[model samples]
Target: MEGTRRTTLVLLLLACLLFLSLLATANSQLRTDFYKDTCPNVESLVRSAVANKFQQTFATASGTLRLFFHDCFVRGCDASVLLFSPSGKAEKDHPDDLSLAGDAFDTVIKAKAAVDSDPNCRNKVSCADILALATRDVVALSGGPSYAVELGRRDGRISTIAGVQHSLPHPDFSLDKLNTMFTSHGLTQTDMVALSGAHTIGFSHCKAFSKRIYNFSPENPIDPTLDRSYAFQLRTMCPINVDPNIAVGMDPTSPRTFDNAYFKNLRQSKGLFISDQILFNDARSRATVDLFASNNAAFNEAFVAAITKLGRVGVKTGNEGEIRRNCAAIN
Candidate 1:
């Protein structure tokens, strides 16, 4: 009888140890209110700063959103994309990132300044956190869901031009390529489709999608998959060998709004980038695209969940990284 009791006690102890281990593993490195005490007004300050920028130019919404995507996808939500290397070789210097709007960087910098203006919060906040908050504000201000963001990420000290190529998905990425790239970061196919919905509020350069409209191939000129009228409109906006710098809204109907219009555009063969259009063309992801196109509420919910997951990618907690005094330079 005593031996039986001893065995039961051992099993109980093992179960407790297992529970504790699982609990620790499940504990996120970040918390929604991490700055509750450190910088009580951090969220409000960022929101105000972002609002001010939006008043000047609605483009700030797209710019900030793109900046967040670039920052998170490369080097895991750290502000490495913001680093300005003196050698003219940095992550942001890469051709893929050349289209990142200056207003986005400016918005983040302005928010950082607002946080620092508070005596107690001066130099106490992480630029990564500021970027995240500003991104959330940009979406909210643009009439999208205002989801709570988890904080406590530290700014990475390293930013290499070479990293950008491997990290960011190109404008011409097919569904398979996008799956591979996003899956590397622990995101699933659903996450990839939902995140792509961010195109609802951004613009693409003429060069980025020129192939879809012109000289797709010798056999198939002007990508037969594109709608006829839509193709004609794009050709008018972006002439062959035209200045690559000319830009057009990704969602021509509602370029500045954050809604399911992007998915709707995809359904109509009006997606600006090949990467965006392929979500609807690919059988593996087409159902998701269709669902989002039909339901704005569903799209918003999925996007918020996916972006929240994105915010946690390879975060640096504890002492792994520093809080940069200047977002563009290492502290």
Candidate 2:
């Protein structure tokens, strides 16, 4: 067993090195000022539009934030997730992608329009860049820390339903599975914990976590890791045969704010999913969860770093990809 453990560690280390190399290459091509000459006002345009959408519906903040994550995780922040196909054959048509907030797509489309409306910025900014900027804007608007977003990503032309399989983490994943997925993206354990903090502003449909409350196992029925009170509360809101589409805040408290409350919730066993509660239940990640739960500043700093690295994954800069005139369709 000890020898197997050593082998796993060695393999994980090698994978981390390989992913780090890819991230280094991608980050080299991305810069905060890539749009300076072509579209100096791109940030402001996206921020204003995102703020308006946030005002119209608080869903905008969580939706857009989730959209950024889904896009990046699936196709490396190229905005391929934004593509639409009337025949329902695109990535957006995938079952996993369908749970994404519809408002998020509208948020990007509107922000793209706002950016192009500027005569000087017309069709000059990539939808990928606009999505990046809008993501930061939503976090800030939702009371999260504001951070710099590196730009210059070009829109990807391919977005197929087949691309989503095994590309993103599932709600039922354990700590080891979460770490493996995140480490493959060149993220550390700290980065995975911090990025998970985005749940601070998001909602999860009942179906995503129903098993924890309803039928975790024949023996327990309810997950023993879940707080009894919280489990009952969840059951009340999502009884058997309830519409799976019915949603609940991921962070029951301060769901609209982008804050460290997510960590705190996990500490209380109020985490909405097995993957979430696992951070506290598993000794390997419990300390990080404790620290983030106790220190908001630490959480914010780590979150910024993790998200910045996330933006660098699989990027296409320079002449590698086209600046899409329509985010839903490749140019």
lDDT of each: 0.89, 0.91
**Which digits, one per residue and each the tens of the lDDT, describe model 2 over residues 92-210?**
89998999998999999999999989999998999999999999999999889899999889999999999988989999999899999888777899999999999999899898988
Ten-residue stretch with the least lDDT total in model 1: 19-28
The stretch of ten residues in a row with the least summed lDDT in candidate 2 is 19-28
The clash count for each model shown is 0, 0
TM-score of each: 0.91, 0.93
Best candidate (score: lDDT): 2
Record all residue pairs in model 2 with backbone atoms less than 3 Å apart, i.e. clashing.
none
Report the C-alpha lDDT of model 1 over 158-264, residue by residue, as the tens digit.
99889887788888898899999998877899999999999888888888888888889998778877887888898999889788778888887888889999999
The clash tally of candidate 2 reads 0
